[model samples]
Target: MMWKIQLFKLNFDHRERDAVLETVDSGWLTMGERILGFEAAFGDYLGHGARCTAVSNGTAALHMALLALDVGQGDEVIIPALTFVADANAVRMVGARPVLADCASRSDWNVSAESIARKITPRTKAVIVVHYAGFPCDMPAIAALCRERGLKLVEDVAHAPGASIAGQMCGTFGDVGCFSFFSNKNLSIGEGGMVVACDGNLSQRLRYLRSHGMTTLTLDRHKGRAATYDVAEPGLNYRMDEIRAAIGLVQLDKLPAGNLRRKELTERYRRNLAGSPLQMPFDNLSADVVSAYHILPVLLPQACDRMGVIEMLKTAGVQSSIHYLPFSGFTAYREYFTAQDAPLAEEICSRELTMPLYPTMSDREVDLVTGALLGAVA
Candidate 1:
C-alpha cells in the first residue's frame, strides 16, 4: 500500500463553494459586503478592542501596518532571528532596518522579552513579536517593555489566528496585529489577510493605505451620490476580493471547532512521546496560553544530527521539515546580521523538525509518523 500525507491542506467543503457561488451571483466581486462581514467577524473573534481591515495577504497587512505607524528610513524594528523572513522584510519595505534578537529556550522557539528589551535603542521605533507556531509569546512582559520605551508593538500573528495568552487574544495586546489567511493557515481564505488595531485613527489610515489612498473604497464609491475622490497619501492596492472574503467567512465559522480538534491531537502527541529522546515543544502554563496547534515541532537532542534524521524519515515515507533556519542565514539579511551572532537560534534551527498535524490527519498517520521518528532517532 502507498502512504500519502501532506504537511498542510485546506479544509474546504460544499459550504465554501456555496459561499463563493453566492458571492459570484451578488455581481459585486471586489471588496464589498463579504469583506465587511469578514472584518467584523474577525474583530469579534479576536476579542480585543480590535477593529479589523481585510487585506490582500499577510505580507501586505504587515507592510501597511508599518506604513501607518510612519516607520520608515533610519528607524529600526526589532524582530526574532527565528521567524519567517517576511517579518523582517516588511520592515525593510518601509525603508526601516530590522534588528535581530534571540529567542527563549523555555518558551519553545519564541522571542524573549528580555532579549527584546536588550536590543531596544534610541533609534528603535517598533518591536515585532511573532507567535511562533501558534504559541503565544510573553505578551505582558513584551507589551510593558514597549509601553515603557514608547516603541510600537506589532504582532505577526500569521500562524496564530485565534490563539490567546492568559485569556486575551494574541493580536489584541499589540499596537497592530496582522493575520494570514493562506490556504495552510488555521483560518484560511485560500489567500487573504487582515489587520486588527485598537486605535480608530490608525484603522482609518490603514483603510486608506490598503486601497490606493482613495478617499473611499470601490464598495463605498458604487453605493453613493459622490462621483469624485481624493488621494490623501501614496498607498498600495492591498484590498481583499469578495471571493476570498467569502471563503474566509466560512473558514472563520469552522475555526473554533478546528482549533479544539488540533489541541486534542497535540495533547495525544505529547502523551505518546513523553519519554522519548525527542523534545516536544514547550508550553508555558503560567501565562495561561493556549495554542491553535497549527504545527507540531519537536527538537532532537543536541547529540543527534537533524538532517540525518530528516533523511531517515523520508526513506520511511514520512515527511519532516524545519520551521526556520534563522533569518540571518538568508542572503538578504546577511549584511545586517550574521549566523555567528545568533548561536541559540542557529542551534534550535538545526535540531527542530516539524511533523504533520493537519485536521484531516488520522490516528494511523500519526502512528506512522511517530514510528518513523522513533526509528530515525534509534
Candidate 2:
C-alpha cells in the first residue's frame, strides 16, 4: 500500500540527469574514462589517500574483496546477523562460511567485538564488519582485535559511506572497505559500488579482478594506448558502466550535504519521539564517531504488537519497515545455523522498526509519523 511517507526516496535532480546525458553523448557506455574519474573522486572523498575500484554493485565489491584477501573454501568469515543478506551471500559465494555474530542491545545495534571473538576459530580467516544503519562500529577495538588475531578485515560500509570514527572514515580502518550505491542508499546511483584499500597491491588486485583480469582496459585501447590486451587470471565482469559512473560522480558531490541533512532530521526524530515507547540507537554513542544517518531504526517494546502497529500506521497514512531478521532465522539459513546463540540480535530483530528518514522529508511529515506511531503504540 502507498503511504503518505515512503521509507526512502531518491533525491536526484537535473545535475544527475545531465551527468547521465553527458555520458550518453560521449558514445562510450562501458567502463572507460568516466569510471576512472568516479573512482578518483571517490578515493579523494574517502580521504587517507585511499585507493578505490568501482564495481558493478556492493555484492560484487564484497566478493572481489574476499577474493583479493584469499578467503576461500574451508575459511570462516565472521559477520553480523543484523545486516542485509548480501553480506552473508558474498561469504558463501566465495566458498566461505559466514559465522554470524549477535549484535549488542538496541542502544548499540551493531555487532560487538566480544561477539566476534566468540565466533572465531582455527578456520576463521577474516571478519566482515558491517556498519549497520550508517553507524560506525567500534573500529578501534575491532581493528585491534583483528590485528591481534592476524585476520583480514573487510568493512561493509554500504550503510555508512560518510560515517567516521575518530575523524578517520569508516572504510579506512579495515583491510578492504566496500560501499553500495543502490537506489535506496544515501549516494544512490541505481546500481553501483566501490572498494577501497590503502595497500597498492590489494588495490591493483581489485582492479584486475573486476574486469575479467585484463592486463589493459578497453579505455586504453580506445585511447590508442594499447592495441591488444592479455588475460591475467579468471575474473568476473563486474565493471560499472559509464552512465552509472557519471551519476555516481554527481551523487558523490552531494553526499556530505545529504548526510548532514540526515543528521539534522535524525535529531528531529529524537526530539519528536521523546518519552515515547520506541528505543533509539546511538543515543549514547561516542563523540569521536559520526553516523552516516542512512536509516532511523527504533526498537518497539517486547510486548508491543509489531504487526498491529504496522497496520495502524498504515491506516494512519504512514509507512514503516523492518531493518532485517537475523540471518539464521530465515529458512534458507536456518538449516545452516541456529538462532539460539544470538539472543540480542534475535530479540532486536523481532522489535526493530525502520521509519521514514530521507533528505527531502519535511517537519510536518515527521510530526505525522510520530503522532501516528504514538497512537499506534497506545
Candidate 3:
C-alpha cells in the first residue's frame, strides 16, 4: 500500500465553515462576539477564572504578556534552550535579555529548575517556561522558585493546550500563560493565540496592548454605547479576527474528543515501539499531569545519525521532524550564549525525532511509521 502521511494536518470540517459563515453573515469581521466567546470559554477550560485575551499569534501573545509585566531594557528573562526560538525572540523584542538555561534529561524536555536558579541575576525579571511537545514542565517547583526570587512567571503553552500538571491547567499555573491556536496545535484556529492572565489589572493592560494601546477595542467603541476612545499607551495590532475566533470556538468544542483520540494513539505508539532502541517520552510523575500528546517524539541512540534517520524515513514515506533545534544553537542567539553552555540541549537536539501523531492518523499509518523507524535504526 502506498502511504502519504504528513507530519501534521489541520482537522477542519463543516463545523468550522458554519461558524465562520455565521460571523460573515452577521457582517462583522473583526474582533467581536466570537472573540469574546472564545476568550470566555478558554478561561473556563483553564479553571482559574483567568482573563483570556486573543491575539494574532503565539508570538504576539508572548510579547504582549511581557509588555504587560513591564519587562523591558535592562531586564533578564530565563528560558529553556530546548524551546523554539520564538520563546527567546519575544524576550528580545521587549528589549530584555534572554538568559538560556539547560534542561533535565530525566524530566523529558523541560528546563531544570536548578539550571534556572543558576542563571538568575539581579537583572532577572521573569522566567518563561515551555511545556515542550505537550509534556508539562515541573511548574510547581518553577513557580515556587519564581515566587521566592520575586520573578514573574510566563508560560509558553503553545504545545500544551489541554495539558495539566498535578490537576492544575498548564496556563493557570503561571502569572501569564500564552497559548497558540496555530494550524498544528491541539486546539487550532489556523493563526490565532490567547493569553490567560491571573491578575485583572494585567488582563486589562493586555486587552489595551493587543489593540494598538487603545483605551477600548474596536468592538467596544463601534458596537455599543461608545463613540470616542483614547490611546492609553503604544501597543501593536495583535487582535484575533472574528473568522479565526469562530473556527476556534468550534475547535474548542471538539477538543475533548480529539485529545482522547490523541491519548489512545499515543498509547498504541508506545506499545508498538516497545522493546525497540528508541527512547520514548517519560510518563508524567504525577497522575494529575494529563498531556494532550501533541507529538510522539523519540530519542534515537547516539550511534544512529538523527538527520540520516529522518532522510531514510522520508524515503519510506514516513514523515518525521525535529520538535526544535536548541534556541541557543541558532546564529541569532550565538551572540548571547555560547554553544558549550547548552550541552543537554545539544544532545537532545541531535537525538530528537518527532514522528507523525494526529487524530486523523490511522492504525496502518502508525504501523508504517514504526516499521520504517525500526528499519532505519537497525
Measured against the true structure, the TM-scores of the candidates, in listed sequence, are 0.96, 0.98, 0.96
- Off-target runs (Cα >4 Å) in candidate 2 are none
Prediction RMSDs, each to the true structure: 1.7, 1.0, 1.7
Task: Report clash pairs, candidate 2.
Answer: none
Candidate 3 local distance difference test against the native: 0.87
Best by TM-score: 2
* lDDT string, candidate 2, 1-378, tens digits: 777888888889999999988889989999999899999998888899799999999999999999999999999999998889998899999999988888866688898888899999999999999999999999999999999999999999999999998889989999999999999999999999999999999998898899999999888998999999988888889999999999999989999999999999988999988888788898987888889999999899879999999999889878889999777767778776777867788888889899999888888888888888888998
> Candidate 3 on 24-70: residue-level lDDT in tens?
89999998888989999988988877789999999999999899999
Cα-based lDDT for every prediction = 0.86, 0.91, 0.87
Candidate 1: list runs displaced more than 4 Å.
1-3
TM-score of 1: 0.96
Worst 10-residue lDDT window for candidate 2 reads: 334-343
